[model samples]
Target: MKPALLLLLLAFTAFQLALCDRNFPSIFTGEMSDFNIETISKANSIRREYAKKNNVANMNKLTMSFHLITIAQRLAPECEKVRPGSIYRYVLLKPDAAAAAHEENLKLYLDYTYARNRPLWNERVRSMEQDTAYHLEFLVAEQRQIGCTFANCTRTVRDEQTLEYTTINYGALCLLGPERLFQGDRPKWYAFDEKKGDPGSACLQGLVNDDGLCVLPPPQRGVTRIPKPTYIPPSTAPPGTAPTKLETDEINDFFLFNELRRNWARNNGVSNMWRVEPDYDLRLKAQKLAAEDCEKVWPTENYRYFMRHTDKTNKEVAAATHEIFKTKIDTILHEWDRKEFENAIFRLEELDRDTASVMEFLIAEQRDFGCASASCARTVLNPKTLEYQTIEYENLCLFGPSGKLMANPPYNYSRTLPPFNQKYGELASDCGPDGIKEPKEDGGVLCVRKIPRISIEPRKPVAQALVMIEPKMEMIQITAVSEHSLNWRLVAILVCLAIMN
Candidate 1:
């Protein structure tokens, strides 16, 4: 985001106040809270690893937040009683044996009786002296455990040679055999019907060669005609406030006025698109958008919104979407050949961007499909022999997983992104592929067994590793600490956060 835009969004004033309110219902910023002092401490410890990656200024943001929070909590008397700069400079950058005599901390540490007063962080230090269990619990609390736990499971794993499988792990989720959810009956291979060339499509023809290089065909030139959505956008209102119904006679002679204005634009060609936003009433008959439709383009609603809101005549948005799709796909296609391509995968994966990877995977899968199906034989040019070899499959039907057909409602999703072209066909959750369907002729409604998903993740191009590590026995045990004990522990969390920065 541009700095101006970011500032406006963060500002208490401006239209951003409305934008900010939309997300206020769920605050996952992970800001400092009093929920758990230990949890905060663990988080602060992890935060330090990330903090070191940046400069001191970035680290100060974390400390400053703690400072602000503490300042806000203090009363006017407490503020007056506080020593200026004392908290910030408590830790000496360097130490000297002689200088230690001048510091008050030396006496507090040396004299146990005097230490009864409790030096600034005495109780907080004691809290850390307990067993490692406390730290483990704070890191991976029981409340967050899922998928697998140690109670019913042992270290035994499946022995492939003996064909014996272990079912101890994942007992909570996999009440049956462990492989029950892990195994699938669906055919693992599916590709574009090669004979039916995917013209102007982003799905390329290729494979990850034995050399570990992507040997894909160059993208074909020219754009195919883009398909409009099957669900015609209702004569609808854009975001913000919904549009109110306008009676036919709401504006006397409105239809005639609409027709006249449209005809004038038709006579003027490209020049008229700029004259004004095509009147929506007039647009009931207007086919395409002119330059003026850009104003009504509510971005986050997805490209479909643009498709519906645009005039079929407006070549600008359509051309833009096409170029965007091609540009993103081309970049991916090129990246596939690079050694550094693996680095493109982000830790916080993006389903939309990962679509490119899936498209390529589909292409690779199809390379085998032709040979796998008996009727169709695939001929491969062997890199080793430079001779073409024909490969064949015994009439097998390849089916990709259920996730390939995903229908996630997008937020601010761009339809022009690669793998989103209409040529790839509409992605529907309950339609073709792994989805169930009714039998033709309605001969006893068709039934397809639905597979239980083992994960919270859907079978999409972007998949996260669903993993949780069991904390040591100590962390799982929540021991109660006294209220006074909590005060300094909480203070330790605040101090650690500030000091870490």
Candidate 2:
């Protein structure tokens, strides 16, 4: 053989060997085994190898997230129908189920490849880098929590040689999460300085070196775990105050808005979404404007606003005002979720800028806000019939002192600097000075901001008095007009009697 040809052949063989180092006796079959531990361990080993090769510090060991496991289970059914296309397309089809997952990797082997002994699970995990460098969930240093599962499936394909259809069995291994990493045209690797620090000195907070791999230290004994309640009722009116239904609703809205923002920030690459407290002044102003009618965007010089409209029934309006304000708020949020705003980046300068999209609610500078809702029946002239009709409308408005809904700036000051920029998952090291690392109920840690005490007083009763007096004055005028007519009639009768005498 020619020397050049032999060298090329050797290089190709080496590449194939790197792609699959270990071979299995047969295809994956039978019921799935509990490979969660093995999967996580092997994945971390690969991560450590990559880090060492790149001269970067090893990231924290990947832990299994049940949240991602549930998502993996959902995808397990689709493995049978897997085709040669983007795996993310399948995930995008079910946005709600997969919203929390940041990335997915799937390794599939058909009958043709099965003839040449399939690769073992660990080998597949190791080959992830060689298989597709862009979708390297295992190699990406930012991803820390993972959920993996295997599926065996069979499908019918036409044999090209025989020109006949044949049934073939296939096996697939799937992995999901660490959540916050956004997969784009190119992979976003963990930022690090090459060969600048000691082997383990580059490890972030909440992580330590476990041998060569960065890992979370074992939980200390005797530590108390706080029991999280499933549900907490909204606050009610104090003793003699008139219902305070609006106040209760505002309180509930404040909590829901902050919770949604926190969840999004934690799952995205955002690090500085401060806890939004209820501002009484903002709430009163929003409520007053909403009550007038929810027709168009109400832009104020000092505040940003998000408004939503829904068709509602009289019963819904009454119920919302008296008892189910939280339900109404939930419905409005659901409407926003249905829009799937997280799927893309939208700028405030987009063609349709009047209405605020989900991006508005996610502005990092939005520190405090208030929400208000109003329901009314509007009379509109039907375009076709030229007849006036009453239409029921429900409007929800959220306003804050800051939080402009512009495009995300190119640089984020909140994100941690190099060597410690991994912000999501179990070993997140990006909590700022006032933030506390708190474990999420599902899995992973969140940098919870320490909210300072706001000394603003409760909403003054002036606005409430103004709302009350309008109706009362109308009632008083109606009574006065009736009494004046009655008095005039009595005087006319007395005048007639005097003329007759």
Candidate 3:
């Protein structure tokens, strides 16, 4: 071969290799630097917004994961086919060796109609965040990594009657992350801490860079560092001084309830709904009642109450109930879509029969309430054989002012009246209209009441108030009649219900 021809042939081969590198880079050793800077910044900005809304100061900014990017690249070819609007394809992929400790979130979008006018990456991300069905993943505080890739593809579709085929151009966006949305039965997307310090103070190493993000400090030189355990020990402060696990759960529940209430009211076209406030007195009364029994109970006149029971411990039952309630909200709203009622009215009769009436509690004018939970084990005796069995119960109770659910037929409802406005000599139209808005740490506002403060007497301690045992004995009979047995046996049992003292 001639020398000049050989050099030209080698040059052509090198150009082809460069093209392959740009089109489909090797996935085995990619890094965060592979993603665009703007993409990283925009994604982090959205996360920051959610963190602020959730009152979390230490939310970590997102970093791009190359493993996720490689996955996205591999799935990009699927965009050539069109899918129905109601169907979204979700594929779970195993993490690579480098990403073994990470979970994953994979999302794909194909715009069949937007071949000519593809949206910019920033706009596309915003659209993804706005989509109600898929937005939760982006809002999750623990999911702090993202990777995305886009592709332009064409699909060929055949007309059913005309016997013609046409090529349609489309754009596809694939997003990958180190975490998936709704990985567990958590009711909310973010963790809410009411006492979190200033912005970025919660970051690892307590550092915030120029972009206003919580970030970890750079690794130090020459020393091997041991990884710390994920669990942090609770403060050793005396009880009632430092927040307990139960108290944290209550705070989260309070935040979730108010947030859900506000969203529901807005969706249902109610504008004058007021935020409920936590009352320590009410909470204590609730705790006392909850420790009494495992059975469901209704509140008396002038107050509203809701109770939930589970086989779990007192600490776990509230979360379990919240998870169950969250799943029922959509169906409840759908069934009541056509109903017409006053904005602030709550009917106890409707609540009494509806299993999903927990939602009604949200709209109920139950301002100033507290929640309490308790667990106990009871022993049952079989009188016939002198056999005993143990059963456990957990209960959660919320007690508050009932909006008036015991009146006459249709008018028998509780109403949340607006707070009186002294400046204008009239009731405030909304929580913020009369300059009585109480700002909360979670970026929410509450309506303030102007009545003179009255001292509330403290109730007896929970240990003393709890009902330990039933004074009366209840008899139960169990009949055993089987096809294989020639005779029938009857067993008599005595149940003495008791709660932990």
Predicted structure with the largest lDDT when compared to the true one: 2
User: What is the Cα root-mean-square deviation between model 3 and the actual structure?
Assistant: 19.4
lDDT of each: 0.22, 0.40, 0.36
Error of 3 at 1 (Å): 52
Runs off by more than 4 Å, candidate 2: 1-130, 133-243, 298-301, 307-352, 356-360, 376-395, 408-501
Q: Per-residue lDDT of 272-297 in model 3, one digit per residue for the tens?
A: 44556556666677777666663444
Model number with the top TM-score = 2
| Runs in model 3 lying further than 4 Å from the true structure | 1-165, 168-294, 299-323, 330-365, 371-395, 402-429, 432-435, 439-444, 455-501
Taking the tens digit of each residue's C-alpha lDDT, what string does model 1 give over 1-501?
Answer: 123322322221222122222211111233223222322233334323322322111111011122222322331122222221211111110112222222223223323433455453344333322211111111111011001101111222233234355322211100000011101321110111111212212221211111211122222223111111111112223444333322111121121112122222221111111101113333332222223232232212111111111122223333333334334444442233122233322211243322222121121111011001122233434444566554321221121221221233341122212222212221111223433322222211122223322322222211110111111111111111111122211222222112111
User: Model 1 scores what on Cα lDDT?
Assistant: 0.22
TM match of model 2 to true structure: 0.38
Which clashing pairs does model 3 show? 58-202, 403-414
Over 6-85, each residue of candidate 2 has an lDDT whose tens digit, in order, gives 33323333332332333223223222324555555555665565555445564555665543443455556765553212
Task: Tell me the deviation in Å of residue 294 in model 2.
Answer: 1.2
- What does each candidate score in C-alpha RMSD? 31.1, 21.2, 19.4
lDDT of 3 at 454: 41
